[model samples]
Target: MAAVPALPVSLSGRFKGSFAYFTIKDRLPQILTRVIDTLHRHKNEFFEEHGEKGVEAEKRAISFLSKLRNELQTDKPVTPLEDELPDAALWNQYLDYQRNLPNGNGEPSWFQSPWLYVECYMYRRIHAALAQNPPIDNFDVFKEGKAQNFFESQEAVIALCTYFQELLKNIKDLDEKQLQEELFKLLQVSLWGNKCDLSFSAGEDSSQKSSPLQSLENMVPYILVNDMEKVWSLLVNAKKNRTERSNVRVDIILDNAGFELVSDLVLADFLLSSKLADEVYFHGKSIPWYVSDTTKHDFNWTIKQLGSANHMWMSRCGINWEGNLKKGVWVFHDHMFWTLPHDFSSMSEVASDLYAELQKSNLLLFKGDLNYRKLTGDRKWEYSVPFHQALNKFHPAPLCSLRTLKSDTQVGLKPGQGEQIQASESEWMGELIFILRHLIELQ
Candidate 1:
C-alpha cells in the first residue's frame, strides 16, 4: 500500500463548530432517520412482495440501521462490518489502517476520525445492513428521493434540453470560436448544477427550478476559479495532433442523481455532437451513495424519463442520447472503488485497475464537491496550496474539477482571495459558490 502523505491533518468532526461537526451531528442523523422512515413506510409493500420473509428482512434491515445511527450519534467506537459483502475485508483492513495511524487511539469513532472516512463508512455500513438480509439485499433506500429530485426538476430539465437541441441544430455551421464559447457555457452550466445536492441539504428537496443556461452570465463572478478555457484548449490541441478523429475520450465522474445528472448528460452529449470527444465515459457509484449519487439504475432512469417526456426538444434529446448509448458513443461504468473511503492518491495501489482505466482518457472531468473532497484527500490544506500538491501523487490523466464549494476544504486560491471571501461571505464555502479547477499544472 502507498504511504499516507505527511501533509495537513484530515478534516475531522472532533473539531467543534466546523462543517465536519455539523455534518456528523445534524445532517447524518437526519439522513438516517429518513432512511428508517422510508423502510417503515414500505412494510405493506414488502409483505405483498415476499410475504413474511420480505417483511422480516425489512424489519431486520431497519433495526440494523437504527443501531448504526445510534453508534454514530453516541460517538461509539467504529466497529467492523459484519456482513459478507465482496468489499467487507477491504473495509475492515481500512479500519485497521486507521487504528494504526500515528495519532492512534486504537478505536476510531465517528467524531474523532477523518470526516471523509467516517462519512463514507456510514453509507457503506448502510449497504451492508440491507445486504445482510436476503430479500432486501438489493434494495436502495434512497431511490424515492432520487426520483423525486428528477421529477421536481422537470422545468429546468426541459429548458436545458431545449438549449442543447438548439445548439446541436447550429453546431455544424458554427466557427471554432463559437464552438469554444458554447463549450465554456455548458461547462458553467454543469458547474452550477452541482448546487442541487441532497446530501448537503440532509435529504431535503434541492432541485433546479430555473433555466440553467440563462443564469450563466450572472453567476460568472461567483466562480472563484475558472479554467474552462484551458480545458477547451487541451481538447482542441489533442484533436489537432491525433491522426484519427475518433480517438479523443472524455470521462465524467458523476455526482448527484437529479438535475445535476441531467446537466452532465447534456455536457457529454455536446462533447460528442461537437466532435470534441469521440466517446464519453461516465463513472458512477456501484451502490446508492450519499443519498444522491448516481447508480446504473439512476442513469438509465433519467434517460428513459427524458425519452418518454411529452416536450418536443426534450424527447428528441433523450432519443438522441439513448441512440448514442446504443452506438457506443456514450458509456457508463460503476466500480466498487468509487464507493470506498480511499482518496485519489491511493487508487494506484488499492484500485489499480480503475486507475489504469482512467489513464486511457484524454480528459477527465470530475463533477461535484464530493469528488473534489476525495481528490484533495479531504485534508486541512492552506488555501494557497497548489491543486496538484493537494492531489498528492494521483494524476492518471489531464483532469478538471467542476465543483461548487459546498465543503470547507478548498485549495488552489490566491494568497488573499480565500481571506477576502471568508471576511465577506462567512458561510460562502458551504453555500455552493461555483469553483472550477484544471489539473494541467502537471501536464
Candidate 2:
C-alpha cells in the first residue's frame, strides 16, 4: 500500500472556494434538487412511454435519488452504502469507500473522495440537489454563464474550422509515411494540451476555455520539427506488418465542448486522413454531465461548425464530413453504458457487446480528465503503479488515454518520480498530463 502523504495543515483557499461554491454549498445541492423533481415530473410519463418494468425502475431510481438528496441537504452522516445493483456493484463499492474517507476537517465533504468516485458522486449528488431545489417548478441545473459563452463563441469556432481546412489541404500531398508522422504529432499536441485544459484552480476557466486551438497557430514549427520523426517510424512499421486489408476504426470516449471538442476533432481528423483509422466512433454522455461532456446535440453542432466554414480547407474536410456520418463510419452512441454508476468494472457485464464492436477498431481513445479518473477507477493508487495494473481487467481494444491530470489518482510514473513530485509541494499528479497507448496485439 502506498503511504498517504502528510495532509496539508490548511486547505488551499482555492480548494475551499471550489467546494463551497461548486460542490457542497451552491451547485451540487441545487443540481440534486432539480434531478429529483425531473424524476417525479417524468415518472408517469416514463411509465406511459415504456410500461410496467420501466415504471418500476423509474420509481426505484427516484426513491434512491430522494434519499440521496435528503442526505446531501441535511449534511447527514455518510450512509453505509453499496451498489448492489446486479450490474454495477464495483462502482458502488468505490463510491461507498470514497464517502467513508476522512476529510481534512474530519467531517467528510462531498468533494473528498478518490478522483473517480468523487466526480461521479458529484454528478449524482447534483441530480439529487436539482430535484430538491426546483426553480418555479422547473429543473435547470445547467444555468451557468460559461456554457453559454462557449456556444456563443462563433469566432473561435470559425478559427478552428479554418485551421482544419488548412490541415486537410496539406494532407493531400503527404505520402502514407508522412501522414503517420503527422498523426503522431497531433496526438502529442492533443495530450500535452490536456495538461492545460483541466480546472486545477478554483475560479479559473479550464484549459479548453483559456487556450483554444487558435492559441497554437504559432507553434506548428516546433510540432513538425520535434515530433515528426518518431511517429513516422512507428507508422511505417505498423503499415508493413499488415496481413489483411482491414480498415482501422478509432473510438474516442469524448470529453468537454467548445474549444476542447474542436481540438479532439482535429486529432480525430488527422487519424482518419493519415489512414491510422478508417472510422471514428464517438461515445458521449447520456445526459448533461461533468459540466462539459459532449452530448448528441454537441456532436452534431461540431460537425456543422466544421462544415460551415467557406474556406477551401474547411470545404475539403467539410465535403467529406457528412459522408462519413452517413456511411455509419462516424457513429455516436449514448447508452446507459456511459452513465453507469460504476467504474470500468461495469464494462465486464457489457464486455461481449463492447468487445465485439471494438474488436474491429484499431484504437480506442479516451479523452479528458474525468474519463481518465473513471478508467483507473479513481483509486488512491501509488503513482508508481503500472497503468495496466491499475486498469485491472478492463482492457478492451488498442487503447490510449489522453488526459490532463485533474485528480489525485495516477499510475505509470517512473521510480521515485512520485516522491519527487510530492516533495515539491505541488499538485503534480493533478496538473501533469499523460498519453498512454497500448496495442492489444502487442500484449
Q: How close is every model to the real structure, measured as TM-score?
A: 0.98, 0.68
Q: Give the TM-score of candidate 2.
A: 0.68
lDDT by residue (tens digit), candidate 2, 88-204? 454455545555556533444344333244445556444443343322212333423225534555455455556566767787788866666556556655655454332233213
Alpha-carbon lDDT, every model: 0.91, 0.56
Model number with the top TM-score: 1
**Collision pairs in model 1:** none
Q: lDDT for model 2, on a 0 to 1 scale? A: 0.56
As a whole number from 0 to 100, the lDDT of residue 443 in candidate 2 is 54
RMSD of 1: 2.0
lDDT of 1 by residue, 1-443 (tens): 99865799999899898899999999999999999999999889889988999999999999998999999999999999887888889899999999999876568999999999999999998888788887878889999999999999999999999989988889999999999999998998898899989999988999899888887899989998888889998999878877754489999999999999999999999998899988999999999899999999999999999999999988998899899999998999999999999999999999999999999899999998999999999999999999999999789999999998888889999998999999988888777367988878535
Ten residues in sequence with the least summed lDDT for candidate 1:
237-246
lDDT of 2 at 267: 78
